[model samples]
Target chain A: MQYSNTIAILGANSEIGELIANKIAGNYPLLLVDQSEEKLYQLKQLVTEHHPKAQIELAVCSKDASWEADTIIIAANEAAEQASIASKIVEVTTCKTVIQIKKAHLDSATLHPMLPYSKFIAVDWANTTAIVEGKDENSLSITGEIVHMCGLKPLFKKSLI
Target chain B: MFEVFFSQVKDKVLLSEAEQKLVKTFFSPKKIRKRQYLLQEGNICRHLAFVEKGLLRSYNVDDKGIEHMIHFAWEGWWMADMLSFLSIEPSTYHIDAIEDSELLLISRPDFEEMLLKVPVMERYFRILFQNNIISKERRLISSISNSAEEKFIHLSATNPELIKRIPQQLVASYLGITPETLSRIKNKLNKNVPNT
Candidate 1:
């Protein structure tokens, strides 16, 4: 399958996710999938506030199925527990990395800062290690490549099984 | 064994046939005697050593002269001082053969040269680094958040073979638990199991 540099932020309305989206949105297509229309509107405004040239679009889950991006990135903490979101993205888009910044399990190893691009944001993303539990090596590699492209580090280990 | 390692790698990173051959060329066979140091502290780690046989460990010595076990490289595992390897700085950790070992060593310059020769290798190494980063992040999170008992259970469930093979002290260090605590936990587990 042909995959583009386009990255979809599953929870784009998120404060940090928006910042992340804004950074990559300039170069590639940025699709924001969120639950709230108001938040989506606010995110669009936020993107325009800093990046007026950014090609940002808002898609609500409440609406019909319209997410058509090559890569899907789940960026919100709330979506971490959403099995539906995970399963849906797994079915459609090719997710490179699922950045779950939940309070319970924070991964800070592969962190990338927004704006001024050089300043390293103190995030758990880069510091947290990934324990990949997958059946095949191709699956792990695909996921690993996505994280690397996002400028995050990842490590591979076999599953308990 | 090399085939097995390559099989594991081929699954994650996509490399062309020619690119794969170039990588296979870097696999220089070397045997390390038990207790021998492949790379020492204060020396730049010039090579990324992949295990072909036997066991090895990478460890850091603290100010108190206590060695903190970073990781163990069993058969078919990769071990290196990543901070030192990537930065080309003097390594603080020492990689030693825990058991008489065999490895395929590739120097940093050769590895980078190989990557340049084959750009797909850059993608492979990038993914490799990411995978390592992910595992480290997960281990740190689990160690900090989970209780000692919980960590033991997790380790036992995940790497029972490692628990059996590695020394208790190293396992304790990996789990971020005291040796005494690990002993106690093991005893508790032993007592809980039926006397068969």
Candidate 2:
């Protein structure tokens, strides 16, 4: 089976997830997944509003939900939920670095026993958003490009860890 | 007790005898009983407390009134809401003693004065902050990435002593799991793995 250059954004209904999707839209074909189909529809409209030509599909993160995409980004409601959804994502794809983009988190380490791959990055997306608000366009673009890179490349192949 | 504190500083930046004395002059020692709060939510954090003996924990009660732990500071660790202490804003967290503890606290003014007087301390503080950032980053990843059982296993493998010392409830909070979840994890471990 040939997987296209499709990027899946889990929890796409989230505010941070939307921002992330909006940033990367038009640049690539997208698959947006969340807890609710209704919310994903709203986000699809929003993404279309910004990138009229961008190809975007949708899925909800239910037990039966699966993505036929190359990469998946998890933007869960909370850390606990993030971990749960991540393990589920791993069950379907050997996709690298399921980046958990969180709004605010105190501190965290690695998932050793669970999916013991070094293909995970716990990003403080709030700080990245702050950069966007601060109008540091260059820095924001660099970060945006880096996140895009994560989507473009399988995490395991580009093992720089 | 202050030996631990001095060693921590000296490890980072070698202080002259006189500069060391100046550093000591800025701090005043205090004792806290177990379960006594050193700083509370809505109160401006005044001093950066350097733990000399015993243990302390920092946490916040969320909207559901569930306590979510921020950290556990033992000997040689510093406890303070850096935002509150620096900005003079109301603290979002509470710091309390987990064991009868001794601390050497320096107010913001004194801490600043020490940094100014003994400029070498700048190196030490910079190292301290860097380590804190690294630790905090690790914690953020671990909290969001690992399962309750995985977290317990990670802690048990890395810092078994911490598990032995801390109560189950607080350990659950630190691991970002419920107390019942923690008990379940321990039960699962007991059954699956041989007790080491």
Candidate 3:
């Protein structure tokens, strides 16, 4: 009942990020991070308009978001951009849950080295069920809780990464 | 530890010795070091705390990592993110001890039980809630309509002891102005004071 984790959604301007933000609004305090300040503000407005009591903050950079949040959701579509973000937030993301919205052939393993201490979980968001992939059981369970909070049923997949 | 709490309750409603003893059973005593957190943002506010000694503050951190002070709880005051405590949801505000503090904390269930067992507590809490709402409304109006100087003056007039106890930086944050601006205002006010 004591949900103490603050979640940061990187690439908050992305469609998936916005979807996740809307789903999780009012349940947890959010740090929405994006390169575009204007887009971040607009996304914040949309989220707050629907869930007026939602605790939402906007960040123009990933470092600021990752530093403050206990969990990080990487919603960036491109693998290259995700890699760049991973490198940038390496220090702050230690021992934190890093949830990636899986796309294409990108493996959570590729990001594992850069964020070695971080618990990585890849969420493949389906219509109603989310396929969650992770190596650590504890991290997987935490991710499941978060996915459940977002109104999605979590289907676990053990990852070799 | 319960002296401050008992006095505050007595101010609102009369309680017998038996009722006071029953009230004491519901609360647990705690001591928090300065800068220690009672409740952090994103955590559910499990307990409502009444200050016995020292000060605590509730604040919100923005995306830029700036803290915006929402409220301060001094001796005989209570602190909690009430919405989170009532709804059992994650809180947006962080409550922390601004000075080394002693507090009496009661969990939501215990609070309810105490009110039921000691029915007079309902009136006491209702009066507290009403006063809290009025204070919040006044703060909201001031933030919207008052100038920085006016805000500082009002705060000084209302809670001058608080201004002296807390750091000026925090005072500036509470007033929603820059520290330099607050310093300038203080200097200007001091200059206007007529010498004997």
True contacts kept of each: 0.00, 0.00, 0.09
Error of 3 at A121 (Å): 38
Identify the leading candidate in terms of DockQ: 3
TM-score each candidate. Answer: 0.51, 0.53, 0.56
For A46-140, candidate 2 gives per-residue lDDT tens digits of 88998899988787752223324434566666667666776675444322334556455534333323433313444455432321111223323
Q: How high is each candidate's interface RMSD, in Å?
A: 19.2, 24.7, 12.2
| Residue lDDT tens for model 3, B1-196 | 6788989889999999999867776765555568768898898898898999999999999999999999999999999999999999999998988888877777787789989999999999999999999989998999999999999999999889879988999999999999999999999999999999
* Residue pairs in candidate 2 whose N, alpha carbon or C atoms collide under 3 angstroms: A107-B139, A107-B140, A108-B138, A108-B139, A108-B140, A108-B141, A108-B142, A109-B138, A109-B142
For residues A109-130, write the lDDT of model 3, one tens digit per residue.
Answer: 3577787657788788776788
Error of 1 at A114 (Å): 54
Report the number of the highest-TM-score candidate: 3
Cα error, residue B177 of model 1, in Å, equals 2.5
Instruction: Give the DockQ (C-alpha) for candidate 1.
Output: 0.01
lDDT of each: 0.63, 0.69, 0.84
Runs in model 3 with CA error above 4 Å? A1-161
Residue A43 miss distance in model 3 (angstroms): 52
Instruction: Give the docking tier of candidate 3.
Output: incorrect
> lDDT winner among the candidates?
3
Which digits, one per residue and each the tens of the lDDT, describe model 2 over residues B32-141? 56876788898888789898888999899999999998888888889899988888999999888899887777768668888999999988999999999987887778
User: DockQ values for all predictions?
Assistant: 0.01, 0.01, 0.05
